[model samples]
Target: MNDLDKVESILFSQEKRFRLVDIPGAGRGLISTSLIQPGDIILRDKPVILGPGVAEDGTYCSGCGDISGSNLNLMENCSCGLRFCSVSCKQSWHTEEECRIVSSIPEPKPNQNYWLITLRGLVSEDPRIGFLQELTVQEGAGRSKEEDEVVKLLSSFGFKEKSILTVYRQLTANTFRRGRGRGLCAGVAMVNHSCSPNSRVWWDESGSLVLSARVKITPGDEITLTYCSPLLGQPSRRNKLLQSKGFICRCPRCQDGTELGTYMSSIRCTKCKPGLICPVGLDEDKLGWICSSCGFKPNPEKVSGLLKKVEDELYGLEKEKDPGRKLLLIQQYIEKNKKLFSSDHFLQLRAGDLMVGLMNKLAPSTSCIQTKEYYTRQTLKVLETLDPGLSRFKGFQLFKLYQILFEKIVHSAQGSLKAEEQFQLVQDMQTSLLESKFLLSGDRFAPPEIVENANLLVRALNQEQVEQIQDKINQKYKIVKSVYQCI
Candidate 1:
């Protein structure tokens, strides 16, 4: 059988809701075999090989999996010269082939830090494991000098020439960071990257990788994953992918800098109201950025200087302890760099998010509350364009809006409101609470604290509902939230 047949057989060997399918130029990608609704768990697979992250932190016990400190320092090296947390850990990691491999290698040297995971992979290798041959590694992503050193080291052990490179190729294209090091999840590795994806992957309690549908996916639709964060606008994301992965994304989001009318990375044009400053499309353009409305192009130095000022101020604000001071600093940042940032750009969205958090902690004033509502609404509007439906980001945004709307209601009653305005505020709170609950009720990506807010919103809604079922609704929330360990 050919390569496709081998991959097909591997994919079908287990119970699966998806299949490997060919994409022109992009090689192969996973396509849903059945219609998948939003929040459906599509696949769960444990990593075939688990090892240390690329940048390994303080040492971990190979045998017991205990991290560095205390008794770990007291423990002696194994016969193979590998440190272990205890005798059992040493015994556990010292399998026959691993011991042979370890015993043959020279001592660790400075600047060979890159070989840590490679060493673990060699240690974990079983003769039964298969090298996935179909995935190609580009030249710059080709074998490293350290890798050649590893190959030379392993060659003395009678391993075949090019054996290490064959395995390394399978690893480079497939692995993702579990913590600091690469996790080779075979099922997850098959799903190719897209900036706007229908599905997402997360780790469940057991550490098995779980892929869930973020949007309703029709049968035969490709199951794509964002290899990098979609929270960033197109240019930052593209540059990151190119720097790390050696691929220029042609995903529709990358092709269009306007980013579905969100203007996610666009600077606001000083010349026009609600106008975007974007990269003028040319491979060798002198005036890098142009206003979308007036064609007012700013020189590269002007844009770069403004961005650096904002960056320095944002960094300084991170160290500010006083909420009032931070808020002042953030506003100053906005006033200082208004020309370089649009409200929709990732940097401003991030600032808005930080400001909202600060507002929550501050004494609730009319100005603070109003600012919270504005920023929360701005965040949700950006979410609609970027993440769209049933996402953790959207869920969190709705929760914030729900809180802000309820705050407005409390403040309205405290200061005395007209009956009509009071009635409308109550109606708006109920609507916001229900929207937040609907979006967040099934979100597995939400942390325990954020997930509990969904219950609190529902409980608040119960008070507004008829008194007859209020007890019943409260009891029901208690039961459901217990499953999430939040009650």
Candidate 2:
């Protein structure tokens, strides 16, 4: 049997949520074998070979690379002085023959994870070596240059150049920045990238790669993951993908300048109402931008200059020392950019992010409770559009939203408010708390401070609030049961 076929068999044999299939327009991709729901961790895969990244140099779990203080033990180092979180992790890293060889090399240099992964893929007795051979590497323009340098490194490990190159391509394309460096997850890596992806990936508490459905996936749907940060605007996402992964994105979002009606790439037209701007189907190139209403085509050079100037101003505001002026400047910037980048635009979302930072600094003060809530709500909306369903970003936003509602109580004397206002506040608080809990449940990558603060907030809620939320949750369960029966 071919090496890749052998590896696929092992993967298929163990997989439960999804299976490998050749998609029509795409090549080999992960297809949902059964229904997958939002927030459900459909798959969890361990890394094939993991270590510190090119820039990272620290004692992380040799097993999971968790550096966030998970009670890691310094019992023993790999032969090369790498620390482990536990005995199990240490044992796991000290692999049969492959990792022993890795440890024997005393104190591997930075960026050696690539070599380590290639070596393990070649010589490891496991079938993952065969699977690693199957991943496609971008090999057109710059491939010729890297080929020679990589081959030299391969030769040092006493392996055939062909085998090494095959694994190298797969590793470069598929490896995630995990385990302190580079982590190769066999099943998770099988999912390809899409700008508007249906799946989102995260790290579980134990550091396993968890893939969750961001949207409903019925039988036989192709599962996809985003390679670049989806939070960035279209131009930025496209630029990053082209530079890093060596591919021009033709995703639906990329082809349309409006970016699914978000107007993220639109320009500010001073002549139009609200001075709105958009790209024109101008001159035959169709690449030129113009006002949506006024049809004002801008010089591309001037557009770039304007964007740079605004970004530079934002940077200055970010570094501003005075908190109150920083917030005022942030609000002023948002007011200006709302015309440039619509409220839903990623740049505006970034403005929301800055306001969240501002809100946090003034969270204890009663003077701006309403303002804090407004920015928190606005930021939550933006995150919903960009990074939807079971994201650390969403979790933090929800947690912040919860804090804003709870702060009304803290700010008030004896937690007093009008009767209707109290009910509305309670309902909003319940919704935010429930969502934040669901989003962050089992999320290991969530900041410890956020997690702890969220916990404290939930605990601070009185018995009456807890009871109201629980009753509503029970009612929801009953409704779901009834709907299921009817279906």
Q: Which numbered prediction scores highest in TM-score against the true structure?
A: 2
lDDT of 1 at 480: 34
Per-residue lDDT tens digits for candidate 1, residues 1-487, read: 8876676676446777887878886777888889786667788867666544444556655533334556666775767666665665455445767666666676663322344445555556542135343344455565567568767766677766476666654555566655334566776777888888887776666756778777778898998887776667645575566545556667767656677778877888888887898754423422267788888888867875666576556778977998888988887776666666776677777777788898898778888888888878887787776774445566567667778877888777665678898887766665555555544554334435555654665565554363333334334333232222211
Prediction RMSDs, each to the true structure: 7.0, 5.5
Give the per-residue lDDT of model 2 (tens digit) for 290-376.
676766777866776777677668778888998898888888988887757766666666776787677777646665777677767
lDDT of each: 0.64, 0.64
Q: Give the TM-score of candidate 1.
A: 0.69
